[model samples]
Target: AQTVTQSQPEMSVQEAETVTLSCTYDTSENNYYLFWYKQPPSRQMILVIRQEAYKQQNATENRFSVNFQKAAKSFSLKISDSQLGDTAMYFCAFRRGGGSNYKLTFGKGTLLTVNP
Candidate 1:
């Protein structure tokens, strides 16, 4: 079974700054996908970034980027030039890529508070 661990339950960042959210997972599966999803006040899960285990290059999308350490099973998300709109509950998720049910396992989440 794969489990996602979010060490920081809550985090805050000043507007227009950078913040990195930490995440670690335990899994024996060789091929898989890691993702960072954001849930705002609307409670809608939005994909921020994704990383394929087979890809060495980290995934990045605009202001969002990931630091994926495959050997250590650590995946962290960095938000650059954060904005008030970025305040949300961020979740880390995993899904097996091959011969799997394709069920997404999610972490508890980290609540992000972007200060004005």
Candidate 2:
């Protein structure tokens, strides 16, 4: 079984600044995938970034990047040059790799408020 945890329930960042959201997971499975999902007011779950457990390199997508520490079971998201549009509920999720069961375990979420 896998479980994701977001220590911070809420976070704030000034516009054009940067913010890092922390996440930790517990899982016995060696192969899995970690993901950061953004849900805006529209309530759409958007894929911010994804990282494979086997990959040593951190995953990055534009201003959104993830610091993946496999040994520590920690995956944190860094949002650079935060914008008003970045304000949303961010969730950390996990899914097992290579199986018929594609179930995802998600954290409670962290509501990020980007202030101007």
Candidate 3:
């Protein structure tokens, strides 16, 4: 079974400042996928970014990027030019490479507060 861990329970970043959320996973499968999801107070789980295990290159989306270490099984999310809207509960998730039920297993979550 794969388990995701977020060491930090809470984090705060000034508006426009950069923030990095840590995540580590335990899995034996070489082929898998990692994801970073953000849930605002509205409670909608939005996909921030995804990294394929086989890909050496990290994934980026506008202001978001991931540092994927396959050997370490670590996938951390970096939020650059953070904004007030980026203040949300960030969760790291994982899914099997090829399965009929690609259900995501999420971390406990990291509450990020952006102070303006």
What would the TM-scores of all predictions be?
0.98, 0.98, 0.97
lDDT of 2: 0.97
lDDT of 1 by residue, 1-116 (tens): 89999999999999999999999999999999999999999989999999999999999999999999999999999999999999999999999998839999999999999999
Any runs in candidate 2 off by more than 4 Å, and if so which?
Answer: none
The sequence of per-residue lDDT tens digits that candidate 3 reaches over residues 16-76 is 9999999999998788999999999999999999999999999999999999988888999
lDDT of each: 0.96, 0.97, 0.94
Cα deviation in Å at residue 114, candidate 1? Answer: 0.4
In candidate 2, how many Å is residue 35 off?
A: 0.3
Q: Which is the winner by lDDT between candidate 1 and candidate 3?
A: 1
Candidate 1 residue 93 C-alpha distance from true site, Å? 0.2
| Whole-model lDDT, model 3 | 0.94
Instruction: Return the lDDT, model 3, position 43.
Output: 92
Q: Could you tell which candidate, 2 or 3, scores higher by TM-score?
A: 2
C-alpha positional error of residue 68 in candidate 1 after TM-score superposition, expressed in Å: 0.5
Tens digits of per-residue lDDT for model 2 on 6-114?
9999999999999999999999999999999999999999999999999999999999999999999999999999999999999999999977998899999999999
Q: Write down the worst ten-residue block by lDDT for model 2.
A: 96-105
User: Residue 99 deviation, candidate 1, in Å?
Assistant: 1.7
